[model samples]
Target: MATLSILNHDRKIFDKKYIYPVLSRRAGGLSLGINLNTNNACNWQCIYCEIPNLTRGKPESIDTKLLKEELFFWLHEITQNNFLSNHAPPDTLLKDIAFSGNGEPTAAKEFEEVINIVITAINEFKLNNLITIRLITNGSYMSDQSVQNAWSLINQTPKEVWFKIDSVDNDDIKMINQINPSLNATKKNIESCLDVSPTIIQTCVIKINGELPSKKSIDQYISFLKNYEKKLKGIHLYSLARPTEQKITTKIERLTEKELQSVADKISVLNLPISTYI
Candidate 1:
């Protein structure tokens, strides 16, 4: 319930003041966020996405120089102003600069160049020690060679990745992410990521139309995770953290803490490191 409380600034639509504070249960500190979709664009129109007026991804290449400059300026300004609340952890505990917004970041044509630019800026500013790079993706673009090449470049940095694996069953995947993802292909991509860098799977634990996933459906997910438990660093399970834009949106609801814990209980049976936030 506490996660639902929007910061005063966050309540206003089209809020362009980037890099705001969110109580990231998994990141566990002041997360320096990088919202690539300042224009409200995304490749996948996920049902759970809270961003309104979503478009079919960005059409042109992102300006790497401008992106780096903007990110550096914001980070420097925020650090100087201490914009976070007093209750927040010290500066050293401030977490990574996350790549998350309205859409998939790897879709940006200059993804590799942008990542390099960001890394250079971090080092130039002498703030690399406290800063980490985090990539949040839906795994839809992993099979693309250019995307993979960009991911390889990002993997060279001190970073961790969070891949969305909302469901192992194809039907459920279509319903949740609104994209028909190939489970086998996605698993292979995830395994490749684990080979190069620290990677984790993030799943949304929610009830659809006031109905929980059947046992068979849950088992399918658990079985998929079980196969990759050896390579995965951990699992970040969270419920609906914000509202959505879809006809079936209101029918979806956040799972209770108990319900989430129960899912974790089942997941632990596979001998994997799992973290639950509801």
Candidate 2:
């Protein structure tokens, strides 16, 4: 007999379709998730990240062949079954294949190769242009030359990049991301990506020390966005949706749907296409 751990690293239950759960508030319906940092590695330790056993970043390689095979098998199951019906077959429906897991997918040295692998798998399933290949990234790797090149190469395949822009003030950003990259540099880097692909700024609003983002902080972030509204595809404003790993979890809370809508309304007043996800 083997000892059982509910959260075993190799105990993923989903197969043939990467990771399950096609419906999501953020990514929308049917998201085929790609977990690049299966080992739970990441550069930034966001207080809100949901991954357990989190570690630093990984420079290791992934089994691309196994990944492609798994993805195809999963898609085959969903398409062949009554995905959303009560008597639905044993397949999970998906809307898109999203590169979102424990860490930044772009941090993988073979990031470019993995993008090709996903594109090939999607085409094999005839999903081609119907489904999106979304990259949910922290935006830190965007400044790296090789990482940017990987994204550029990925442009050959149909996809979307959701860049995280949690805060505009340096101190606030440092508090959330724990990184010290210059805000001006990040804006320029994101602008660079816009030239190549449609980029959505994904922002998360949460409370700190029992308080929401200060009025000054929110104003600065909005002001920053106003300047790049023309260059951006849109804004994704979402609050916390999952339990956090920080010991101070009690200190944070998700903004109400109404509160989020208010923020969206302000952004709309700026003439920016802003969407709120609560």
Candidate 3:
């Protein structure tokens, strides 16, 4: 078996279909990742994205049959054998089945159907009680009915949504995410998700062009969190952990551990639990 470590997450582990695994820092163990967007496409081209040749658009089509086959096969291996000990570090354990891949997974045409398929497989394999089902999304398509239906189903299980909220300032958002996303729309979408389930705010704070986000930018972000404090699970404050393939990589830099902690301190004022992954 190939050695799998959390330190290396750039390469696809399985190189097959939509299923793969990684030692997730946020998850604190081995995570089985479902990649619905095999085409390497995304609606937003985040400057710090690690996906190579990242382009604009949603996923074309998903082969649900193959996806089901791959997911069940891997689940059996992970549960029935010593797959974790053989590939990952000794302390690692299966944490969650995460929908996180090359792009926004909710953009897939079969988003709700895919979620149902995963849920069915989890039940079939009797892994529903053992692992959590998680969706790591940018929260772009959350307002869509299909996506909302999927979220409703996911809320029934031991699951969470890692909703990305890098910055609240529209200009900063455009600069970082490389798209013109409506601030109000994003907020509404987040609220919609929170209405059904608690969400973890995943923020990736980094230096762009050798400068940290301005005080105003940080203030706006804090205010945004303040509005949704009651509905949030916590904040996942992290910095860049992998090298990027985007052209803007030259302008991006990771924050130091101290800097990350300092930012966490600022957010701590909101009184939400924070997990820092610097």
Point to the candidate with the largest TM-score: 3
Candidate 3: tens digits of C-alpha lDDT, residues 167-211 = 989889888989886878988889888876668999999998999
lDDT of 2 by residue, 42-96 (tens): 8887777777777777745787887777777667765665444432223324568
Q: What is the lDDT of residue 248 in candidate 1?
A: 61
Please give the lDDT score for candidate 3. Answer: 0.86
Cα-lDDT of candidate 2: 0.71
| Residue runs of model 3 more than 4 Å from their true location after superposition | none
Q: Which residue ranges in model 1 land beyond 4 Å of their true spot?
A: 1-23, 85-92, 154-157
* Model 2: pairs clashing at backbone N, Cα or C within 3 Å: 16-73, 16-74, 17-74, 22-30, 22-31, 30-94, 30-95
Ranking of predictions according to lDDT: 3, 2, 1
lDDT of 1 by residue, 53-132 (tens): 77776735565566666677656655765445443435435567787766777777767776777677677766666767
Number of the top lDDT candidate? 3
RMSD of 3: 1.3
